[model samples]
Target: MKGSSKTHLRIVFTLGIIVLSIYESSSQFLNDEFCGNKEVLTLDYRKKPWKGKNQFLLDYLKKIDYKDNIDSVRFRIPVKFWIYRNDDGSGGVTDERVKVFMDSLNHFHKLNNTGFRFYIREIESVNKTKRLNLGYFVEAPLQTIFNHTKACVNIYVCDFIKKKANGATYVVRGTYNIVTKSVMLQRNTSSTGLTHEIGHYFGLLHPHRNYKSGKNKQESVSRTRAYKGSLKKGLICERNGDGLADTPAEPRLNFLVDNNCNFSGQALTDNWGDHYQSETNNIMSYPTHYKCRNNFTLSQKSVMLYKASENKYAKYWNTKDSANKIYHFDIHEPDNTVKMASIIKSNEKQNHTFHKIFTTGKKGLATDKTDWLKFELNTENTSNILIKFTPDKIVNDEITITIYDEDNKLIKTINTSKQIASSQIQLKTLKSGWYFIEINKKQSVSKKLYNYSVELIIE
Candidate 1:
């Protein structure tokens, strides 16, 4: 405690991020949808011309000789789940179902080693009968009601979706809506359904472009036909459906794929007369059974990464930036006792400061929702200790800070509520000794975790 205010103290701790293995799952379903379809287009994909943007991205991509180690860079995407149920709250998807779906979703993405990781920022429930069923007609009303923050990928899951589509992703043009940023799905949608929809949200086009109209133009089964650096050589597969050179061209697999997940229909050919040996397990395909729709080609992965990297999609990446800017710990941790409180000591510097990002709520099997730390005061001449907690916009959780002397005698307590960001405790004529500080949330939201940050400075 001697040189508390005069010491320079620096606390450095890096969060250990462990990537988990995604679980494998297969479920059966009949139909699916992507934003390219006019029915699900929020601002009308035709008016927005996001496809042209995709073409531009593809053209730029073709110029680069890019190769990745897969593990070198992992982009974090934040997601928010909106679960809708009947007015009685009787028919919505459960948290367990969400966990399962997320597991399989991550699994499909990891299969391609896409380096894109989706993490849940929040899960909210809506008990409105009108929103229990999803369709384009109702999309506007839903959006208005929620007034989506567009802060992250918004996924709305309802009891039922319109026919012929298990899920729909809005495709906006010119970066306005970035419509592909939002997704809507049926409550019972298969893992493949969600995966397919999310693929569209990230700018993936169905291999069988415009197939529902029965006027599908065949993509040439050649990856090198358009390497001349000319967009006018447009009929080349590189300039055709889905624009990536790696995916083999094929007709819609609705009835062409059979029970064993194999192509069972007549052999198809491209405009250039090449045979179409289409992949049955492509994640962006319209396989008869959702079970057969499984993975993305490497080229598809690249396109998604490109789309997500754009400035318009900065919100998703900003979550990762915020995490890096502050120190984060496990939601179930910081289990400190009075005897084991984190210690802070200052030597020769005028002030010592530490910043921490943490979570608080009734969760896990850990101790109550509280954070504990201790600091020593060498010579108590009016001590200034500042404790500040950045408020959670969604939760707005109240917090109480208490200080205790070495003998566990109560010294001072400050209780803050509703949008309060910081609190301070000033003691005059204090004695030199170790004091314990405990921070706790006044109320908790059931099953939902809230993020909190604290900056502690002693002078």
Candidate 2:
């Protein structure tokens, strides 16, 4: 800690990033649940973000007309993760989830050019001990639960174990502790949750922090203290909404998206009558649906880059590396999937079973994460086709089925959540030349095992 921040950063390139050698290329994304979807988005914004007009360290230096006695280049940011389990060292999180989480993140971080790369230092295991019984700590832990290192960002992954308090039960999806720079998450958290929490670590805020938790008011806890400025708020971020110009003052959330990845509705005004628009692609906003969320606005990126230039990552700030080493672990993506997706043909018994795993690829393209199947109606008269999902323990809780006519116009979307054994959809009216069916899982496919049979019975 005594060496020149610049010199030390420059020297660490030889140390290299140390992590488990196992790599995965495929990943899974969580479905968006809440309009402010069930995937909870929370951050510790007590520490003001670095992008205020008067807030950046560079601003202060420029205020006094300072010169460059110091170099300001950020190297790869380092992040360390912690996995929590029972006292006996059980229930550690899986690498599958970790790979999907990190790989998907690295994909975005690399694409966005947030001006900094990231390296996972290590994933340490913290078992519950006598002094610390971390059985269930969500809203806040008793005393900063585990030992934390001074450098590198720390994230804690634990179970969804928390007690009801203040007439509420905290599910504990994600929380960032400003005091320790530690992020806590439920072991089964999704990309949206993980990304949102990390956004807080880098100094991003929710666009609608001023008002409208909507039906989620109880969970909103306390309202944001940022200046609730009216429409066309000033660029001064600290005192204004979410502190970014590109992001609109959203009333709440309407995370719905069309095939083009654009918001499905018009700008919704807040109670303040502030002209608020939707941010379906924003990493900072809580989307109403899943897989549609991607990318940070240009201004948000600048703000994060500035925030990353802070004192915490002194080791990485001044260092220069010839290569940006990102992790590529083994992915469980669907096989035989083409850019146009795979086809589902009926077998000898006229039964169709899909084997490939479904995913909404990066950029969350319209057909990105969906599995496509082509069906032809042999009979001249209209056929009554019954499409059903036969129970397989491995299949996800919810399977979304979309039907498209030969011309590629959407006919209908079947969003089914509950069916232990079988869920069927009868296409009563269909004069098909060659129709298409799309199937995708809306939740966790942690096991990567997909087993479902589709049978089209003509009546």
lDDT of each: 0.55, 0.50
Q: Which candidate is the best by lDDT?
A: 1
Off by over 4 Å in 2: 1-73, 129-140, 143-145, 161-166, 213-238, 254-267, 271-275, 321-459
| Candidate 2 residue-wise lDDT at 344 | 47
Each model's TM-score, in the order given?
0.55, 0.49
lDDT per residue (tens digit) for residues 333-386 in model 1: 222346435564442111211212223234321113565667777777476666
Clash tally for model 2: 18
In model 2, how large is the Cα lDDT of residue 378? 61
Q: Compute the lDDT of residue 83 as modeled in candidate 2.
A: 73
Model 1, C-alpha of 115: deviation from truth (Å): 1.1
lDDT digits (tens) for residues 1-459 of candidate 2: 656886676445212211100010011012222211112233334365443342454454454343333323344555666776668977667655665566666666655655444445556777754322232332234223335654566777766534344455445456555434566677766676766777777766666554433422211211232333563222333334565545655544544456566665455544434443465777776555546667776556655665665655443333443221111111222211222333444431222223221122352201113445566776453646776656445434667878777788887787766544676777766774777777766544332223555665657
Top candidate on TM-score is 1
Residue 52 of model 2: what lDDT?
37
